[model samples]
Target chain A: MAAKVDHAQFRLVIPSQTRYLNLVTGLAKRASLVAGLDDATAAKVSIAVDEAVTNVILHAYRGEGEHSVELELRFTEQALEIHIWHTGQGIRSDQLVLPDPKEYIKHPRKGGLGLLLMSRFMDEVQFKADEVSGRNECCLIKKIS
Target chain B: MADLSIAVRHIGDVAVILPAGFINAHTVREFEEALEGQVQQGRYKILLNCKDLNYISSAGLGAIMGLIETVRENDGDILLSNLQENVFAIFDTLGFTQLYRVFPEEDQALAAVAPERKA
Candidate 1:
């Protein structure tokens, strides 16, 4: 994390534990605000980042032995970009289909909901996974209006 | 992160759950268990008084989704009341406001479920 307010860049690394989710979300909220996003957009970005980080901990590092999740926040002239890196299982966005809330309640699954919310809240979402290198990355962007 | 605190109280047959603090992946288990406890006890008329709840992630919402079917099957429904504006926005964005009934006040929500208790 940089102390330069004008640059507005941040980097955080947390162990793959759910306990640190709040710290990640707090930084996301502050970073989004510092990047000149409004309160509503900042809140959404915070949630998207939280969901992204939560997925890394719960799904990417499932059953893992003390892994770390790397997160980077960059504010560009056009958008606020958040990148998350993990060394566990990768995510397939093609397989993630957002379900209707009414229909979803009938089946009610715990998985995929976080990703679905992330997709809805953020302006752009991209995923890259290297099965051989065990490096998986997800990037979420929210454009500045 | 402030720990999630849940206090369950009864308003006639309705079991009101008051959860305060953030409900992210870390604390979702406690929220889920509290809801489950009410269901297991066969008390299905649940009202979530979220006046003091500051934040809730998808994991928290999933807990409610996981049990809605059974609760409705038993002729009981989970009603939500006193949601903070930010919390309500999350529910609305996910189309939950349409699936579940939400009231501005706890009294209004309880009256909808326990109409007989109305004065």
Candidate 2:
């Protein structure tokens, strides 16, 4: 992975609002397509990136005030790597636990499915946060087929 | 910032909400409000025409899910139509396909909403 740092990286910083989520997802989709992805794969990258950034805007910033979410996409020969950065309340690992699809289907809830979709669409998902700096990063990687 | 805009139409007893733009956290509130208005008016049978919708995520799905029981309780249902392939994938990925009725065409969804009525 270290040797693959030669890949081009595109960074987009947008206001942490759900409306701006498309800007990030669009970038991810186009970045993936430019990196040699098929239409379906590009769509997956867009959806996954959309969900990740939405969580930051809704939960991290708690949907209030003005904040910025930076989305960086790196196109390596083998993968499309995405990183999202924000200064908001970072989620605990346990918070990512989602109910079984059957459970939600039986008794539908309005939440607890973002992480599931992200994990399902992307090949790799990771979270890193610094409590002191209040900065959190969500990393998503999808291997090129 | 892209906002979600909802257009309302009445096909007999059903309320057809034509949503345009992105449906996510920022816009789900407005989405819910639109549903709430319908729910308040006792218009429980609803159909969402997503032809102009550019995008959607879990937040938008959640909003739709939150209102299901209420609408069903009123002997009505909220069905979706004209889901772009990419948008439909999210629903399929999340197992919403089994929970909601998703159609390929707006007229098909509207027809499904009220089988007794004419388009």
Candidate 3:
């Protein structure tokens, strides 16, 4: 008999702490399982998901307690999509730059690598900031095939 | 959540520390502490067996870089072996493979640490 597949959605709240990256990683793992992704693909999804959530926690919230972040994961037969929404102040997406490997390795900066990793691992990564809605959204999509 | 564990073993002049599980912010400190303790004891040559290490974050990689600097400042070196492909990708993406001495096996790492002296 073929394995039955069903849609799954999970919502998790992580405090604005670096340690919370683990929580995001775990959630991505679960999402991968639900989406029936292979081991390597699942790992890539996990890394990309963690990077996206970490950006929200670090940049959007800045480890502050005033804002809470929500991670919503959706799984389907075709793909797995993760949405990270935060109530913290929104920043212009165009301002973010992909880390140049040469410059980063030479200087070894602390931040900015998160977005690079996310873009490298995910099939589709989009950042949307809505000032009027008071929420910043980062969407990551990975094909299960 | 991913858990990090460390095991330290001594082999000749080198100390082989195996860190298993995920290397993230929660575990980065412990990882740093383990290496710092070895450095404090004057164990300069170290081999990190990452065969069983399943995951590593940027913070974890940064911790490794910090430890390398710490050990090198005191005339020590660290070699990494058995890096999984996923971990290798992270290293490659961050351009760490160019900076660190990475080996395919523990023996290679140990040999790199203590080269044979010809008679």
Q: Of the candidates shown, which would achieve the greatest TM-score relative to the real structure?
A: 1
Better of 1 and 3 by lDDT: 1
What 10-residue stretch in candidate 1 chain A is worst by lDDT?
A2-11
RMSD of each: 3.0, 2.9, 4.4
lDDT of 1 by residue, A26-49 (tens): 888888888889877778888888
- By lDDT, the candidates rank as 1, 2, 3
Q: B25, model 2: CA deviation in Å? A: 1.7
Can you give the TM-score per candidate against the true fold? Answer: 0.91, 0.89, 0.83
Point out the higher-scoring one by TM-score: 1 or 2: 1
Ranking by TM-score: 1, 2, 3
| Candidate 3: pairs in clash | none
Q: What residue runs in model 1 are displaced by over 4 Å at the alpha carbon?
A: A1-8, A63-65, A105-110, A130-133
Q: Write candidate 1's Cα lDDT for B20-113 as tens digits.
A: 9999999999999999999999999999999999889999998998898899999999999999877888889887888899999999998899
Best-matching candidate per DockQ: 2
Model 2, native contacts kept: 0.83
Q: Interface RMSD computed for candidate 3 is what?
A: 2.2
Off by over 4 Å in 3: A1-10, A17-20, A65-67, A76-78, A109-111, B117-119
lDDT value for model 1? 0.87
* Per-candidate interface DockQ score: 0.62, 0.70, 0.40
Q: Which residue pairs collide in model 2, if any? A: none
